[model samples]
Target: MNILFLTLAKISTLKERGIYHDLMREFSSHNHNVYIVSPIERREGQKTTEKKEGNATFLNVKTLNIQKTNFIEKGISTLTIEKLFLNAIKKYFSKVKFDLVIYSTPPITFTGVIKYIKQRDNAKSYLLLKDIFPQNAVDMQMLSKKGVLYKYFRNKEKELYNISDKIGCMSEANVKFVLNHNSYISKDKVEINPNSIDLQLVTDVSEENKKKIREKYQIPYNRKVFIYGGNLGRPQGIDFLIETLQAKSGDKDVFFVIVGSGTEYDKLKNWFDSFKPENALLFPAIPKSDYDLLVQSCDIGLIFLHKDFLIPNYPSRLLSYLEFKMPVLAATDSNTDIGTDIVKNNCGMAVHSDDIKSMINAIDTLKKMDGAKFEVLRQNSLNFLKKEFQVEQSYFKIIEA
Candidate 1:
């Protein structure tokens, strides 16, 4: 089978360890030829190019920066990407007859591309519904539902859904939301296909190595380290995270290690500069290998989402925490089931993002757990990862479509 994947994520090679890369590798390993159409943002100073790694071929389409840019620039980029991707597919993969067209969302402007493929090659289309678009923008008050821009994107969103033969949502909440909101979409077409990755055994970092990492980062060895390693953007509810740090400033036993960059990075950095919180340390995004080591060294994993969001967000970062056997602490909106799932599985605790007192209390709960109890939670995290987030599960789900 020849699979063509359309995505906004930049994938230079299939060797990289990411949700998409792992799933693509799974398809490739099964003797399928996977073709990817991903962006090469203008900031990368690269032209449209095609390359192959293993059984996958990546057609890197050149486009304006759609992420971490000003609203106007980001909007322009998002509006233009679909056309750019369609042109690239025609130029580079004109002869290839795709058996399946799998794509993810952020910009739901890929209806044209998908329609073309379905008509040209009679391909089966699957949507990896990662974001609930214009609605999410409206939830954050970034766009007005009454505005033209909202109408434009909303129409595109409908078109994209209509074109897809199947829609793979991240959670049950997402599937429900899609069905309720889009009455045109049949229930049989939607199912839970979460953010999954290739499972790797958790290896314990030696105490000496852990000590070296702590020393290198100036983290206290005796303190319980809670690490948040991902985009520090508006969707993450950065303001609440800042308030949490301020509230925990007096705690001497807990340390916060934040590592990520985004539009909200400066806001968080400014707060760190003003408060100089003794219990917290902030760093820009680090290399993946270094970040993996940091996750292993940390005592707790943290995830945050804006309380305003009505969309059910399931961040892939949870998988990282689980794969490393670290218990999680998710401060999220009520709509998302991520926090609830973690607690139900006995992997960790979840608190409402708007409730600072609840978050603080949850941290204290973690702090109070004895080594024996904490070890059980860590094992639960690993167990949840293996059961729910394996790349093979995602591969089978898409193929079954």
Candidate 2:
């Protein structure tokens, strides 16, 4: 089988670890020919290029900056990406007949590209629905529900959904949301297929190594460390995170580490500069290997989502926390089931993003937890990951489609 994957994520190589990379590698390892088409944003100063690594072929198409760019350019890039990708597929993979076409959401502009593949090779289309788009923009107040831009993307979203043979949502809430909102989509077509990764055996960091990491980062060894490592954008509800930090400023037994960069980094930076909170430390995005070590050294993992979101957003960062056997503390909108899942599995605690009192209390609870119980929560994190988020599960789901 020749599997074609289309994503907005920049995948320069299969050597890197990510949801898509792991899934594609699974296909490649199963003796399927996997072809991945991803972007090489103009900001990267790279041209369209193709590379073959084992059974997988990577075709990186050049386009306007699609991620972390200003609104105008981002919009233009989204609108034009389908055409760019279509042209690249025709030029580079003209002779290949794809058995399956798997794509994920964000731009919601892949209807044309998918339509072409379905017609050209009679390929089955599977949507790895990672995001609920224009509506999420409306939730963030970035897009007006009554505006033309919203209507256009909404139409695109419908087209993409309509064309997909199957839609793999991140959670039950996601499947329910799609069915409830889009009356036209059949229930049989949607299922829970989450953000999964190729599981790797992680060696527990030695106590001495953990101490070395804490010393290197200037983190206190006596205090429990709570780390949030991912996009610090509007969707993450950065303001609420700041409020939580301010509320915990006087705490002596717990330390907060916020890492990652995005549009909201400056806002967080400003607050950190002004308050100089003694209990917290702020760092911009670091290299992945270093970040992995940092996460391993932490006692707890933190997740935050904007209070306004109506979409059920399940961040992939939760998988990272689980992979490292760190208990989670998610502050999210009511719509997402991530918080619910965490608590139900006894992996950690969850609270609404707007509930500063609850968030603070949850933090305190974790901080005061005894060693044996804390270790149980950590083990639960890994257990949940293995059960729900392994790459083989995602591979079988797509292949069975």
Candidate 3:
């Protein structure tokens, strides 16, 4: 079968290790011809380009900067992406007949593109529901529910859902949220298809090498390093993260590493400058290869979500921590099941994002855990990753639909 996948993520090649890349590679490995329509954001200085890696073809549509920009530009870019992508697809992929169409959510403006493929090729459409929008914007208070913008996107959201043959939600809560709110969506049409990655052999770092890594980063080798590496933005509740850091100012045994760039990077940098907490280190985003090595040296992986989120957000960053055999610590909103799943697997602990004391307590608990218990948690982390987040499972979920 020939498959067409759509995403806003700028995937340059199928070799990149990410959810979309890994999933498309899985389809290609199964002898399917996978074609991806991804954007080449303004920073890349490209008009429209096409490339192929093995069995997969990437059609890079030129697009405006959507992420890490001012609100006005971001909004304009988001609204315009669908038309740009649709035009690119028609120009480049006119001859190719797609058997399956899979796309993710962020901007739900892809109804026209999906409808075109479904009607032109009689393709089965699948919505990889990574995000629930407009309402999420409302939850963050980014947009007023009564505003015209909100109404427009909300209508687009429903149209996208209505066009999908299946809606693969990231968690049970997400599945429930969509069905309960949409009312028009069939219960059976939605299913749990969580964030997943293709498993790779993670190298084991020797104690000597680990020590060198810590020394290179000025991190203490004796302390347990807790690292948070991903987008640092509003949805992550950056203010609460600063408050938590300030609350744990005197702690000497636990080390913190915050890495990643976003609109909130300056806010975090300002806090780091003002406090200069000896236990924490801040850095901008690093290469994926380097980040993986850093994860291997860390003892704990950290996840944060805003307490205001009504939508259940499952961050894909958790998989990297698990792949590195590090137990996780997720401080998230009540609605998200990420924290619950981590604790249930006996791999880590989850605390409500608003509760700084509880987060500090979780750190204390990690510091007190014995070697035997830590090993169990480490093993549990890897086991859970293999069972729940393997990309092959997601491949089957889509193809079988």
Candidate 4:
């Protein structure tokens, strides 16, 4: 199968440690020809071009810095992606035929591009639903549900849903949310394809290596490490996380290590500015090698969502932690469907989204567990991923369908 992928993310001969790259490699290993059209976020001196690595060929399309645009202007940025990305795809693959077009969504404006390709080549288009929009905006109060803006984007979203050959959601709740919103989409065409963790990359290292990593990061030689790594954005509900740190600053044994950046990065950094959390350490996003090492250095993993996120996420970070044989502590609502496995497998605990007391208690519970119990949790987490989210088993079914 020849697959065409479209996204606004920077994919340099495939991204350093991204979910899409994992699936692409898996597909390519099976002898599927993989061609990707990605967008480059313009930097001061960066170059734009295509690079080939392994079986995957990467092309960087022209894209606007939507980060600098206003809300309405940024919303329109999606359309430009369709125009630029499709142009890049056609210029590169004009004579080649794509068996399938897998369009990942956030801006949700690629419906036009997908439609154009389907008409031009008579191909199947799959909507890989990463972030459900309009509602996610509503959850963050970025857009009002009853406002004129909501009605307009809502229509745009519905149109996209109707055009896709199949919609693959990140979680069951995400699938349910889309079904509830639109009457035209059939149940047969929608499927649950969770955000993935590359199972093959999972590793278990000795305590000696963990100690070296801790020392390298200036983390304590002996202490419990609770890691919260990923995008520092509105949907993540970071204010509550900030307040949790403020309330629990006295806990010296447990260190909360934060990594990654986003629009709300400045807001998160401001609180870390003067106060300088003794119980917390902040690092800008690291490379995949370092990220894998960092996860192993920690004793427990964390997932957080703001209380207001009506359609919350089942963060792929959870799977990454599990892959490293680390237990999880998630602060999120039942809507996310994250904790059921934790409870059943005894991997960790779950607490309410904004309840700092509960979060602290979950941390304490993890700290109290013996090494044997910790190992049990880690093993269970890895076992769960092998059983549930193997990229080949999961994505093949989606693509073959």
In TM-score terms, candidate 3 sits at 0.98
lDDT of 2 by residue, 1-401 (tens): 99999999988788989898898888989999989999999988989999999989999999999887767888899999999999999999999999999999887999999999999999999999999989999998889999999999999999999999999999999999999999999999999999999989998999999999999999999999999999988999999999999999999999999999988999999999999999999999998889999999999999999999999999999999999999999999999999999999999999999999999999999999999999999999999999999999988998887
Which pairs clash in the backbone of model 3?
none
Put down candidate 1 lDDT per residue, 159-182, tens digits, no spaces: 989989999999999999999999
Clashing pairs in 4: none
Query: What TM-scores do the predictions have?
Result: 0.99, 0.99, 0.98, 0.94
How do the residues 1-401 of candidate 4 rate in per-residue lDDT, one tens digit apiece?
88888776567664455688777777777887888877776543454577778778888775766543446657767657677777777777788777888877777878777887889888888888887788888887888888987887788788888888888887677888778877788998899887674576555778899889998999996788889898787767888888877877888778888988766778889889977998898888788788988888888888888788777477777878878888888888657777766677777888888788888788888888888888888888888778777787657766777
lDDT for each of the candidates? 0.94, 0.95, 0.92, 0.78
* Model 3 global lDDT (CA atoms, 0 to 1): 0.92
Model 3 — which ten-residue stretch has the worst lDDT?
66-75
| Of candidates 2 and 1, the better by lDDT | 2
Which segments of candidate 3 are over 4 A away from where they belong? Answer: none
Off by over 4 Å in 4: 44-48, 66-73
